[model samples]
Every structure is written in structure tokens, then in C-alpha cells.
Target: MRLLTRFCSSFPQQTTSVGARRGGINTHNTNRHYNSLNASSSSAADQVPVLDPSSLSPSLTRGIHVFNCPDEVGIVAKLSECIASKGGNILAAEIFVPHKKQTFYQRSEFIFNPANWPRAQMDEDFLKISTRFKAVRSVVRVPDLDPIHKIVVLASKQDHCLVDLLHGWQDGKLPVDIKCVISNHERGPNTHIMRFLERHGIPYHHLGTTKDDKREEGILNLVQDTDFLVLARYMQVLSANFLKAYGKDVINIHHGLLPSFKGGNPSKQAFEAGVKLIGATAHFVTKELDEGPIIEQMVDTVSHRDNLLTYVQKSQNLEKQCLAKAIKSYCQLRVLPYEQNRTVVF
Candidate 1:
């Protein structure tokens, strides 16, 4: 492999916001155990058949790299050359070069032989490229090797979104290790939610919050080791202090199209407005209430025939599915927060 370390090191210094530790990589474990969590079901889910990751050739280990840097020429060429030098084959790649931001973003998937390009050397090779470009973010993920992302789900009385996430996790649709489920509302002893969590060995916490005590401290302690947090139709607004202390990504699902009917009873708001289309938006939760960066949105047509109840039902269905889709995309490393509360979903 071409050791471009010396050449890359010669480049002049620039401000770097790269999140990975120097000389190392940003690697996270993906919760892909559902493939084995339900071994029999896995076979049927893939009736059409596809490449089995377990059966991959020992010479071909899959790797995905996400790169962000200043917009400049030859970035892609250099990245491709790096992988090629390491005896890696690029299977798929996507790059985003925007006009206003003058920045570069890329997600590249490749396969290589660890026997030839050991993991440490592979990271070094990519680190060289990242330095050469003065990248803001440069990270690689080996899904097969990384552990599942650990997360906690927060919800209120609403159970639709929560239940869908549970099923998705059970079936392996979501590659996440749900550390626990937290809610402000209490559940009875024999409830299905309580029982399923009990059977799976997932912990559950019920917090009672008032203005005086939002119980963010206890919640923070519960999620201290988690990679991220999810609000599945969670009703309470998180305080700025809570978000600052958490200092990690928090995703929330909104029942209405954002920048539209924003607050509570959005369905009612849309229904009264006589809108033509209603939608659900799943986005990152910032301190600014429902105004965070959006990841995925699902919309459907509304008509005069639809009543307030119908609107709510339709919105609930959309909300459950949209949130799950966003979480899946996030676990797959396809959702990236971008400039001005936007997202670059690859």
C-alpha cells in the first residue's frame, strides 16, 4: 500500500472540526444481532436472496467511510486512490458538494482484504487522506465488525411509535441496542409494553416530571452511556439545559409537517385549516422545540371526507412509520446533520 502519510503531513494546517480522536477512527457498533435474534425469520425475510454477510469471502471485508471537508477539486480522486492502494474495491459511493456552503460530503462503501490491509493501517491510510483535505468530519464504519449502537427511547402516553420501534428492533429492522425505555406515564403490571420489555431484559423507567423537577438528571444518568436518545411521540419539551448536558444527538418524531402546524394538536390545526396534504416529520431534537433538523418525512393526501379522527389516525400511522425509518437510517449512518438545521440523508 502507498504510504501517503509523509506527503499528507506536509499540507499546511487548517481549522479542523473532525470528531474522531487524532490518530484513530470513529467506529461504532451496529446492533445487527436481529439477524441472529431470529435466525429462522431471517431466512424468510430474504426470500429473494442476497449476499449473506456471514458468507462474505475472508478476503473481502466491507467498510463504509463518511467524509466531510471544504469543497475542493480532487478530493474524490484522492479518496478512491487511497482505497485502491489498500487493495480495496469501491462497491458504492455518494458525494455532496453544495453551492452555498462550499463544502464536501461523501459516503463511500468498499470491500477489502484485512489480511492485506489490517484495520490499523486502514485507519492510518484514511487519516492521511482526511488530513490532506483538512476535513471537518472523516469517519469509517465496518458494520460487520462494529458493535450495535446503544440507545434509549423516551416516550409519553403515546404508544404507537414506541410499539413500532420495539417491533422493528425485535425483527432486526433497526440496528440498535435499546438500552432501556423511559416514559413519564406509568404502566400497569400486566401491560403488553411492560411484559415485552421484561421478557427481552430491557429495563424500563417511569419518571414523573413537573416544572420544578423535569427529572433530567435521573434521565441523563440512565442514558449516560447511550449513543443517542429517541423521543417517540414524547409530549414534554426538553429544556435547553437538559440538551446541553446530554451533549448528544436526540431524535424526535413530529406529527405534522414542520414550519407549518408546529405545536400540539397539529392534526386538529391541519384539519381546521383544510389542508390538502398532511405529513409526519422525524428530526433531530434541538432545544428549539420541534424546529430541529429533519431526517425523514412521510406525507399523504387529505380530503373533505376526512374528519378530525381520521386525520389523527392517518397521522398516527405516518408518525410510527416515519420515526422508525429515521432511526433505521441513523443506525445505518445515512443521516448527517448539516448546515442551518438541515440534514444530508444519503
Candidate 2:
């Protein structure tokens, strides 16, 4: 938005010496007159251009802009032309149209030179483009800080995964803000999870679930204030309504390789199956359980001596790594949803 100008210069010098000896006084000045002449001559050479932010016009900030439009050749062409006219560049985009919805969504990063065009004129130009394409627009500024993503973690009586996340956040290893911790079970008021939250000053919500709809209600309430959701070993299955309400905002870390040991006791199931590798998957929450778009997945080799306990340990480690990676990708806006999955640009 603001620009600064810099200047550099070089100056020549001369030396003069004055001394008094026993028999005579000696004085010497070499090139003194020449140095003064040269200094005067080079006075203009030291002058540099000055840039005043207040005197100049403002420029547009860098950010991402999302557009939802119709899936038609004419519409796409018109959109592209409009963007180009406004000097907007498309960095990355994905188009998804299922069935006859006729809806087209795109995410693009563009540079808005506010210095060239005033803020009002810039908005006016974008408004005209939106009207021409009959689209909805949303702009997100490029984060200037540490870019810590706000994550609302949900857990039910599980401490290992939640503890790992806590430690990661505390050590600055995970660029995340744990907005709150929601749990379905009441492990007293002084449990490990509660104590960790207290230590970090993060809010902890204990939404005890009893009825069939209780879990859904609690999860929905917790997600209301969060930018995204992280299910860190939450054993309960979320209701269909909850998943639809949150859409792709929810991410789950499954302790087993997806499309294989999906349900319960996945580690034991893997060991029983004599699988050579044990791993974890981090995926978006969809209508179908464990079938959402996979953001990240990792696996570790397993030997014959690996028992159920060893497999669980390995799986937990993999789960933390995969989930953290997925969260980081989401925060960086590098994960894009495609047909039943996601494309991680980074």
C-alpha cells in the first residue's frame, strides 16, 4: 500500500597537516582547494528522490477472492475478461459442479493496486464485474501475522491426541489457536484435558451427551464460534445434520488407514488383519462417515513383533502428524476441495 524511496551517495576527501619543528614552522595543505571545488561540484550528486506516503495514492493489498458463478462458457469468458481488465490474476482455482446445480465456485488471488486506483474505484470495478457475471464475491486479506489458524478441537474421553495437540501448540510447533476444547464425557473437573486447558487459558466446554440428539446439539454449538473443527480422537459419530451444517469446516483424524479399518478399535483391527503398515488419515467430515475428502494421510512400517499396543502407539504418532499437516494446509489456503476429495497445492 505504501512505498518508500531510498538514496545513496559517495563523497571525496582531502588531507591537510600543520606542524612546528625546532628550527622552523612547517604547514602543508594538499588539494584543499581542489577538494572544496569537487565537493561543491558533487553537491547535486547527493540529492535523491524522496517518496512521501501521504502525498501518494494508496494501493490495493494482496489477498484471495472467491467467486460463485454459473457453469457456462459465456460466463467463464466474461469473468476472465473482466478480471484481466481489472489487472487481477488467477493464482489457483477449482470448478465443481455436481448434477444440475449449475453452480461454479472459484478461488483466485489477485493484486489490487490501490495507488493506481482509489479504494472506491477499485470496489466499483469489482462490483461491475460481479454484476456482469451474476456472481457472489468474497475477499480475504493476506494475513500479516504468524497466520495461526483457529481450530476448535472435539474429544471424548481421549487424552493422547488432545495432549499431543496441546504440546504442539505450546511449543510453537503448530501454527494454530486452540479456541476451545469440547468434550462429551465429564472426566471430573481436574482431568488431564481440563488441566491442560486451564494451564493454557483456553476455554473448555463439557457438553455431556445422553440422548441421541445430544451429540449433534453440542457439536453444532461448539462449532458456531470456530473457523474450523478438529476431531482429535472423538469416538462418537456425528449426526448427518451436523456434518451438513459445518460442511468442509470439520476435519477428523482417524487412527487407521481410511477405507480399511474405519470404525472402532482400528489399531487392533489392523494388527488382527496382519497388515504390514499402520497409519492414519485426516479427512474432511462429510455425510458419509470417514468418507469425506482426504487432506492428508501417512503410514509407518510394521514388523511381525509389533503387537496391538505397539500398533496403537505408531498409529497415534501418525495421527498427530497427519492432522497437524492438514490443519496447516487449511490455514495456508492450499487445500482445495475437488470431486469427493481435495487437492493440496502445497
lDDT by residue (tens digit), candidate 1, 1-346: 0000010112222321122212223223222221132245456775434345568687688988888898766676788789888887666565555435667777777788888888888889899999998987788777777777899999989788999999899998898999999999999879989999999999999998886888888999899998889999888889999988988888889977786888788888889999988999888777777887777888998899988888899999999988888878777667654665555676
The global C-alpha lDDT for each of the candidates, from Candidate 1 onward, is: 0.76, 0.61
Q: lDDT of candidate 1?
A: 0.76
Put down candidate 2 lDDT per residue, 5-109, tens digits, no spaces. Answer: 111011121122111111122223331211122244356665332223234334434545455555444543454455567665443333333334455445545
The candidate that achieves the highest TM-score relative to the unseen native structure: 1
Rate residue 196 of model 2 by lDDT: 76
Q: After the best TM-score superposition of candidate 2, give how far the Cα of residue 195 lies from its true spot, in angstroms.
A: 2.2
State the RMSD for candidate 1.
11.2
Superposed Cα deviation of residue 291, candidate 2 (Å): 0.7
